[model samples]
Target: MDKSQLLERVIELVVDITGEDEVGEELDIDLFEEEILDSMAAIELLLAIEDAFGVSIAPTELEREEMNTINKIVARIAERL
Candidate 1:
């Protein structure tokens, strides 16, 4: 998928995993700061991202700060893709 499509899918996964529709609409929001993504939810997100993009996200490979926002998550996935 292209970058836009990848980002949309990431957003969808975030919204689905977090059960927060606002996250899908706010691309730049800090998911952790907003309390939309806690530790458990983050694990779910990483798994979903892997399933969706076929990109493995080794937990130790990324710092929480590096993947705390939708934009950052998209960039990381795009890079892996």
Candidate 2:
């Protein structure tokens, strides 16, 4: 998938996992800082991202800070893709 498509799917997964539509409200907002996502939800997100994009995300390969926002997550996934 292209970056925009990837971004949309990622946003959908994040919204579903977090049960907060607010995630879509700000593409650059930090989910952690906004309390829209927690550690458990983050794990769920990682798994969902793997399933949705067929891309593996090894925690050791990157810092968690790289996943602090939607755009950043998409960039990471795009790199893996």
Candidate 3:
């Protein structure tokens, strides 16, 4: 998928994990700093991303700082794709 599509899907997954529709409004916000994603939610997000994008993401393979925002997540997925 293209970047916009990837970003939208990532945002959707984040919304599902955080149960916060408002999160979609701020694509650049830090999920961890905002308390929208903790460790457990991050793992769940990784799994969801794998299922959605057909890309395997090992938790240990990525730094939280690299995947802490919707934009960052989209960038990472784009790289894998």
- For TM-score, the strongest prediction is 3
In the range 16-68, model 2's lDDT, one tens digit per residue, is: 99888867768998878888877888889888988988887765676767898
lDDT of each: 0.88, 0.84, 0.90
Q: Model 3, which residues run further than 4 Å from truth?
A: none
Give the distance in Å from residue 18's predicted Cα in candidate 1 to where it truly belongs.
0.6
- lDDT tens per residue, model 1, 3-80: 888888888898889788888677887888989999899899889988888999877899988998899999999888
Error of 1 at 4 (Å): 1.0
Stretches off by above 4 angstroms in model 2 are none
Which pairs clash inside model 1? none
Q: Between candidates 1 and 2, which one is better according to TM-score?
A: 1
- TM-score per prediction, in order, is 0.94, 0.90, 0.95
Give candidate 2's TM-score. Answer: 0.90
lDDT comparison, 1 vs 3, better candidate: 3
lDDT accuracy of residue 67 in candidate 3: 89
Ranking by lDDT: 3, 1, 2
lDDT score for candidate 3 against the true structure: 0.90
Model 2 has an lDDT value of 0.84
lDDT (Cα) of model 1: 0.88
TM-score result, candidate 1 = 0.94
Backbone clashes in model 2:
0
Instruction: Supply candidate 2's per-residue lDDT for 26.
Output: 85
